[model samples]
Target: MSLSQQRRFPRRRTSVGASRDFVTGVLIEWQLHSLIEDIELCVSELATNALLHGAPPGREFSVGLHRVEELVRLEVRDSGPGQPVVQCPDDDACSGRGLRLVRALADDFGINDHIVGKTVWLVFKAPAAPAPAPAPLTTPGSS
Candidate 1:
């Protein structure tokens, strides 16, 4: 089965938490409860980056979630210039480590440059689908 959902968020400080909540709700609806924490963390970081660095004035950022079979993909898109970097800042620095943390948590991560902006995406392995139950056995004369 394949599922896809997306939502746009304004360029504001509050959007980071909104983005996390959005993805969490979607995951719960999809029955992927096991991934809520990791996915939520990634969404928060990416949304923060978008709000701070990527979302241009009057332009909105968007979050996309897609699931195909046992694979789930999360994406954050924005219309600002310059690509995001994974930096290993000094230990004392309180910020600039979001991308680095994302890289460590995601099973697969990459960037897609669009004509206007870019999309940062992360992939995760979802739990396998449950097996179907067997039909009840019946005796020769059973109804």
Candidate 2:
């Protein structure tokens, strides 16, 4: 089965934690334990970036999750003006590490630019499904 969900949040500092919690809850419901940690971290980074650089005044950002087969996709949309870029921060810098972390953690990462805003997306390759249990053997005349 496939599942998809999207949620919007105001451009606030709290939205970072809220986005992480939302992703954790959905991953738990979907039984994607293996991906919870990595995905949560990626979501947090993206959400924080959205709140810090992407969201304009009085505008909101959105997060979306889609699971189909052995892959899961995550997205964060913000009403910002510019596309996000990966930066090479100085060793002593305090900021500019979020996109780098996201790129390192996600299997695939990209930005979807629109006329109004942009959507930062990440894709993860889910764990393989477990093997089915073997059938029990029956005697010829057991019935």
Candidate 3:
């Protein structure tokens, strides 16, 4: 099965959170509940990072989702400059753990440069199929 969805938002801190919630709702509506939390957090963190570092003023960002075969991908794009450097956030640092968390949760992830800004993508394995309904019980003397 394949599913795809996308949305764009202005580069703003509040928009990042709202976008996460919106995307999470979409995932749940599509019966991809298993991935809702993880993907939500990943998207939020990445978007927040983009807003903080990438978005300058009037730039915008986009989030795209693609379900191909047994894999689902979440991509966030922003109009900021320079690619994000995936580094280990120091213990004493106030921030910089966004990418680290993305790396930990996403099965496979990467950074891509776009004409305007950059896109950070994370791919996850689709959730297991729901078990089949059980057969009705039969009693020896019932029939």
Candidate-wise lDDT, in order: 0.95, 0.93, 0.86
Measured by C-alpha RMSD in angstroms, how accurate is candidate 1?
1.9
How many clashes does each candidate structure show, in the order listed?
A: 0, 0, 0
Which whole-number lDDT from 0 to 100 does residue 43 have in model 1?
96
Q: Where in model 1 is the C-alpha error above 4 Å? A: 133-143
For each of the candidates, the C-alpha root-mean-square deviation to the true structure, in angstroms, is: 1.9, 1.6, 2.5
Put down candidate 2 lDDT per residue, 18-130, tens digits, no spaces: 99999999999889999999999999999989988999989999999999899899999998999899999999999999999999999899999999999999999999889
For model 1, how does the per-residue alpha-carbon lDDT over 67-121 read when each residue is reduced to its tens digit? 9999999999999999999998998999999999988999999999999999999
Q: Which candidate, 1 or 2, has the higher TM-score?
A: 2
Best by lDDT: 1
The best-first sequence of candidates by TM-score reads 2, 1, 3
Task: Tell how far residue 64 is off in model 3, in angstroms.
Answer: 1.1
Q: Candidate 3 versus the native: TM-score?
A: 0.87
* Pairs that clash in candidate 2: none
Question: What's the CA error at residue 93 for candidate 1, in Å?
Answer: 0.8
| Candidate 2 accuracy as lDDT | 0.93
To one decimal, what is the Cα RMSD in angstroms of model 3 from the true structure? Answer: 2.5
